[model samples]
Target: MKNITCLLASILLAIVVQAQELKLKPRKADALGGTAFAHSISDSTLSLVAREEIIFREIKNGNVPSFLRKFQKIVSKATIDNKDYELVFFVLPDYLAIGHNDDYFYMPMTPILAQKVANLLHCSLPTRKITDLIDQNATLKLTPQPIPPSKAMTTVPVFITHNDLVKQQMQPYLSQHANGALTVGNKKDIVISNKIYGETTPRVVIYGWHQLDGKPIQPLYNKHTNTWADYSHGVRLVQNTMWLNGKKTTLAKILADPLLSQLLSDEGIIEKSYYPVFDNY
Candidate 1:
């Protein structure tokens, strides 16, 4: 009887642990989502600094792409410390974008804003190990299209251009995913790592713009300042919730654990796995 009861409980726990979904907080009524807001800014003559501020504010107040609300679940299982472990977690189906309804554009921001958005949505950036896992398991893999780097890469015009390019790339997939799907390889991801823990000046760590061959173009690099956001950068949020060995856990907690940290981190224990969110980076 005891063994039978344990088996039933295990089955019930497995059912509950599968593919959890996370929804973003509700936006205010009549408030603009990511759609009208991004288009308006592209046509305006606002300075780059001004545009970034408003973009951050709009996102903070919940003006994000509607598709972002439906977080996609990803599961990873592995053996660490001579024990098998399974991790199930939720992530944004698409890279963070700004829009409402069916209209939206993927937006890139500095690590400062990325961390702030993660905090707002109760999500965190991915580690290198998880970044690779997402790419490997994503349903759609878009070829990365990197615009030539220039000073204007940080400008709104480039952002709009990149958005159009990405939309064009997605046209063939629209029949399958009208709004979005679990996608990867289109842009370099803003990631969390122990690399930033001791940097003299705060730096943004980016990785993973994989090719059709499944090889990444960028490496785990942190030379860029947290304030330097380019057109190629993307923010994909991973929900803080993590299921470890069929029990409720979090990235911060598991990452701090020496043994379980092997599941998601390539750099060993990442006790501090996120950037410090701040007004000035």
Candidate 2:
């Protein structure tokens, strides 16, 4: 009995140590953005549509916050069919934000705009498995902040309010990762799902917003139209190019691979990786 107890303790200790050793470094995205675009959410006359245009314009001109320029390296290791594989990818340290670091607002956009921004930045949206991998390896995690449902949920004021709430939740760690480190939780990700394939109706698929204990508040869902976006929704850009088994490859190739797609997608393969672009946004 004593020998069995000792063996169980040893296994527990190993698991604890492995969890404690999880850490990641920022991959410098110096060329991404440094120009600061200062915008105020207090503008009541500006409609959400107008605000979205301004957000896109600034980002297109490379006027995003300095912190977002830092991509964090996320590594995932898996063993399938008795073969070991490791995939390394980089992601923006946090959700896509607008304006200066001190005055930024986490911008929520329709899937159309999200796709446009992703294309402009040479980035891609995360999959369900990718979201889980990122959350599991995130340097810091926070509780999800959800506002009461209302028409204003898609407005800028509510968006700023939720952003501020998230800031408060992450306040204690601000000093260590001033510009917003690789963080998980706080917003539901606009992800690529297999459901989007061959659907006659355009829809938005979202997942994530994990709690501190790593349980996700939102499950894989696509009930909303593609153009619908709310304060709780956030867009995270993943670097298109990733390292697959030590060889640099594109997410396009990896996601379309027969077996390798499992690393980044839970629901089989993601053939239609992006939402159809709408110019009206």
List, residue by residue over 1-281, the lDDT tens digit for candidate 1.
97898688679666764544444556666666454666777754776566677777777777665566776767788886677888888788778876664567788888888887788778899998888888887888999999988888887778878888888888888744545478887789999998776778888999999887789999999998877888899998999987775677899998999888878888999988889776533
**Residue 266 displacement (Å), model 2:** 0.6
lDDT of each: 0.79, 0.75
Best by TM-score: 1
lDDT, candidate 2, at 235: 91
* Number of colliding residue pairs in each model: 4, 0
lDDT of 2 by residue, 16-124 (tens): 3233211222323442321223235447687656766877776776555666776777887888789998887787778887655555667788888898898887788
Candidate 2 displacement at residue 179 in angstroms: 5.4
Stretches of candidate 1 off by over 4 Å are 1-23, 27-35, 42-50
Error of 2 at 184 (Å): 1.4
The superposed Cα distance between candidate 1 and the true structure at residue 270, in angstroms, equals 0.9
Evaluate residue 87 in candidate 1 and report its C-alpha lDDT on the 0 to 100 scale.
Answer: 85
